[model samples]
Target chain A: MKIDKESIKKIAHLARLEFDENSAEKMSKDMSKILDWVEQLNEVDTSNVEPLTTMSSEVNDMREDKVGTHMSHDEALKNAPKRDSDYFRVPKVLE
Target chain B: MEKFSSFDEIKKSLEKKETDCRAIVEYYLKNIQTKAHLNAFVDVYEQSALEKADQLDEKIAKGKAGKLAGMVVGIKDVLNYQGQEANASSKILKGYISQFTTTAVQRLIDEDAIIIGRLNCDEFGMGSSNENSAHGKVLNALDESRVPGGSSGGSAVAVQANLCTVSLGTDTGGSVRQPAAFTGIIGMKPTYSRVSRWGLIAYASSFDTIGIFSKTVKDNALVMEIMAGHDEMDSTSSRKPVHPYSELLHFDKKVKIAYIQETIDSSALQPEIKENTLSVLEKLKAEGHEVEEVHFPLLKYALPTYYILTTAEASSNLSRFDGVKYGYRTPNAHNLESMYKLTRSEGFSEEVKRRIMLGTFVLSASYYDAYFTKAQKVRRLIKDFSENLLADFDYIIMPTTPTTAFKFGEHSGDPVAMYLEDLFTVQASVSGVPAISLPNGKDKSGMPIGLQILANSFKEAELYAFSNYITQITS
Candidate 1:
C-alpha cells in the first residue's frame, strides 16, 4: 500500500503518460489509498476459489475465418490527428 | 397527449401522421437545447437527424416503414456512427470522426430509428459519475446538483428528460444501470455476445456490453431485439437466433426470484435504498410468484476483481490510442516516446490517467501474478458463485446501487468512494450475466432508487420476462 513517488513515475511511463511533479505527488497519495482499500481482499480466504478469466463456462464461440474488406487506408487514417498520405505521422521513433 | 408515453404510442402517432418525424425530431431537439445546461449531449446532429426523418417519412409513404419508423434514439459517444464525431468524451479523441457505423446503431437505422445525437460519458467509460467526461459532467434530470450516474450518464439523462425515446449506453461495471437508477429509467446490460460490439470504442473488451436505457421495459426489449444478434465483424457476437422479446411476457409460467440477503443487509447500503428495494421484493411476493433469499459470498470481492480485470484489459485496448493514430497528437514532442507521453497526458483526463497508471501497475511484468492473476482468480470465484446460485434461482435480485444518487461533488474528491458506488453491480459484469436496473421507488429526498435483476448468461428473455412481471405488479 506504500506507493513511492518513483513508482508513480515508473507507472506513468509504463502507461505511456506524463505526470508533472505536483500531479505525481497527488497520484502517489491517491494510488496508496486505492491500493490500501484493495488490500482488504487479501484478508478473504480464496484458497479454494479458482481465478476467473472468461465469464461464460461455455467456450469456443469463434466465428468462421473469412476475409472481408475493413476500412480503407484513407478511411482509417481520416481520424488521425497527425497523419501523412500513407501513414499516421508521429514524432520519429528512432533518433 | 401524454407526449408519447411509450414506443407503441409513438408508432401509432407516426402511422396516423399526428406528428411527423420532422416535428418529433424538432421537439426533441428543442428539449435537448433547453437542457444544454446539463451537458447531456456532446453533439446534436440536427441536419442529419432532419434528413433521416425525411427519408423515414418517404419510407412511410411507400408503406415500408418499420416499428420504430419515427422514433429518435440518443447514442453514447463511444459508439461509431458514420461521419459523426465519436469523441468518447475524451480530449484524446477530440475531432475524430467514425468511418463506419456500429452494428447496433446501424441496425437501429435499418429499422427506421433516427439518430438524434451523441450523449456524453466519462472519458473511455472510466468513472462511476459523469464528472470525468472532457465534455463536462451531465446533471441528473431530477436534480441538477446530483450526478446522473455514469459513464452512461448522458444517455440515461436524455431518456429521463424525454430528449429521445430511448438511448444506447455501454455498461462496463454499472455504466448503464447505475445511471438509469439515478435518473428513474430502465437500463439493461444484455448477456455478453448477445449484442454485437463492432464499432464500439473498446474500454474493457471483455466486460464492455452495449446496453439500452428506456422509459419502459417494453421499449428496452423492442430496441434490444433490433440491435441483438451476430455480426461477422465482431468476434464475440452470438450466433444464436434473435427472438421477439415482447412475446415472452405473455407466458404465464411462474418464475423463481432470488434476492441477495447479504447484500441487502450490508451496512454500507443507505437505509432508503434498502427500504425501497425490500418494498419491491414485497411487491413481487404479493404476486403469485416465488421469492427467496440466496447467498453469494464471493460477491464481496467483485469490485476489486472487476477493477483488476477491466483495468488490465483497458491498458492493452487503449494502447492503440497512442496519439500517432486516429486521435489527438502533440506537436511539441521531439521524440516518439515524448509524443506518446505528451499527447496522452494532454488528451486524457486525470481519472483516465489514474486508471491507466493503475492498469500499468497491475499488468506490469513483476506485479501481474500478485495483482492481475489474483484478481482473475477472485473473478472466477465470483462467476462460480453466480453459476451455482443460478442452478436454484431463476433470477438474482439486489439494489442496483448501495445508495440513491449522490450530489455531483459528494464523492468527486474521493476516487475510492466513487469506485465503491459500483459494488452492488460489478458482479454481473464479472459473470457476464444479463442484468437490468428498474426504477423501484423514491428515497427520502424523493430521488429514484432501482432494483437490479440478474439472470444466467444468455438468458435475457427470462430476465426481461421477470422484469416485465415485476414492473406490472409494482405498478
Candidate 2:
C-alpha cells in the first residue's frame, strides 16, 4: 500500500496534473495512508458478488438515436479559451 | 414582514393579499444582504429575481400562477444556470458560463420558483468541508467559528438562515445531509435517477444526486415533487411516476425501523448524538412502531467502498477540464502536455489533486483489479446488504454525522479524517436509497444533532411522510 514518489509522478502524469517534489512527496504519503486505510475493504468476502456499477435497477441502456437539445455553432464556441471564429484553438501538439 | 417556513404559509399570505411575490423575494434579498458575512451565495441575481417576482405577482393576481410561484430558491454552484457562472467553486471554471440551464433548474423555474442566486460549495463537490471552495468557505450561521458541513454547506446555510425558502444541493455521499445536520434543517437525497442529472456538473456521477434543503418537510416534498420527474436529457433518469410527495404527508401506519447497533455504539459518536438518536428510537417504540437494533458488519467497509468508487469516477469525470474548451488556461504553457498539466495544477485545490491521483493509481493497469475491481464488488455487497435489510425493515435510523459542526480546520489536516465525517450518511448514498436528515434537538453546546432515516429506493412519498411525522413527534 506504500505509494512511492515515482508512482506519484506516474499517476499525476496520467491524471494530467503536476506537483512539485515536496507536494508530490506529501501526496505520496497521503495516498499511502488513504490506500492503507482502504485496504480494509479486502476483508469483505465479495468473491460471489457482481460489481454494481450502475445505481438504478431500471435504467434505459440506450438513448434514442434522435437528436436532443444541443447548442448552436456560435453557442458551442462561446466558452472556448483560445478560440478562433469557429474552432477552439489549443497549443500545438505536433512538431 | 414575518418569516415564512413553508410554501403553504407563503401561499396563504398571497391569497390574503397580505404579501405579494415581490415582497417575499425582497424579504429574502434583505436577509441575504444582512447576513452577507456567512458567504452563502456565490452570486445573487437581484435584478433577475425582482423582475421574475413582479411578473409572478401579476400572474398570481390573475389567478394563473405556477405551482412554486411564491417560492424562492438558491442553487448550489454546480448546477448550470444558462448564462450565469457555474464554477462548482473551482478556479478552473471561474469565468465559464453555462450554455443551457440544467434540467432540474429549468423545472424549478418552469414552476415559477424565483432563483435568488448560486450558492458556494466545495470545489467540484469533492471536499466534505466548504473550506476547499475557491470562492472561500461558508460560515455556519448558528456558530460562525465552526465549519458548516459541506460540499453543499452554502445551500444548507441559506435555508438555515432563512435566506431562501428552499435551496438545491447535490449529495454524492453526504454533502447535503451532513451540512443540513450541521445547520439544523431538513435535507433530502432522493433515490438515484429520481431527479434528472442532465446539466449538473459532474463529480462522482454514480453517487451524485441533486438534493434539497428546507426548514419544513412539506416544503422539501413540494420542491422534490417538481424536481423528481424523468427527463429526455438524462437517459439514466427513472421513468417511474413521481408521486405528489407534498400531498401525501400523512402517515397513519405503523412501520418497522432498524438502527445499526455498530453505529450507535461506536466510540466516535458524540454522546449527545447517541442519546438523541436513542431517545428518538424510544419515541418510535412508544408510538407502537417496531424498532430493532441490527448488526451491519459491513458498515465499516462503506467508507472505503465509497472513496474508491467516487475517486475513480471523479478522475475520469474531471478529465474534460483541460484548458482547451473553457475556463482557466495557464499563460506559461508552451505546448499541449504542459497546458493540461500546468492549468490543472494551478486550477485545482490540494484535495482535488489528491483524489485525482488516488483515482489514477487505483485504475492503473497494474493495480486495477486489486483496488478498482475489488472496491466495486464491495460496493455491491454494501448496496445489497442495505437493500435486503430495507426489505424487512421499513427504515434505518441514525445520526447524520458522528459529531455536530466542528470548528474550522478541525479535520482538514488529514484527508482520511475529513472523509470520516460522512461515515453515517454514506450508507444511504451507497444504497442509492432515499434518506433524510431531520433536525434532532441541539447538543449541550446548542449545535444541532440530525436524525437520519433511510428507506427503500423510489419510496420518496413514504420517506417524506415518515420524515414529516418524525419531525413533528420529535420536535
TM-score of each: 0.97, 0.99
Return the top candidate by lDDT.
2
Q: Which residue runs does candidate 1 get wrong by more than 4 Å?
A: A48-50, A56-67
Model 2's CAPRI class? high
The docking quality of candidate 1, as DockQ, is 0.68
lDDT of 1 at B434: 89
Best by DockQ: 2
CAPRI-wise, candidate 1 is: medium
Q: Relative to the true structure, how large is the alpha-carbon lDDT of every model?
A: 0.87, 0.93
Tens-place lDDT per residue, model 2, B55-165, is: 998898898999999999999999998999899999999799999999998999999999999999999998777999999999999999998899999999999999999
Candidate 2 docking DockQ: 0.80
lDDT of 2 at B289: 99
Q: Which ten residues in a row have the lowest lDDT in candidate 2 chain B?
A: B229-238
Candidate 1 C-alpha lDDT tens digits along B129-161: 898988988999798889999989999999999
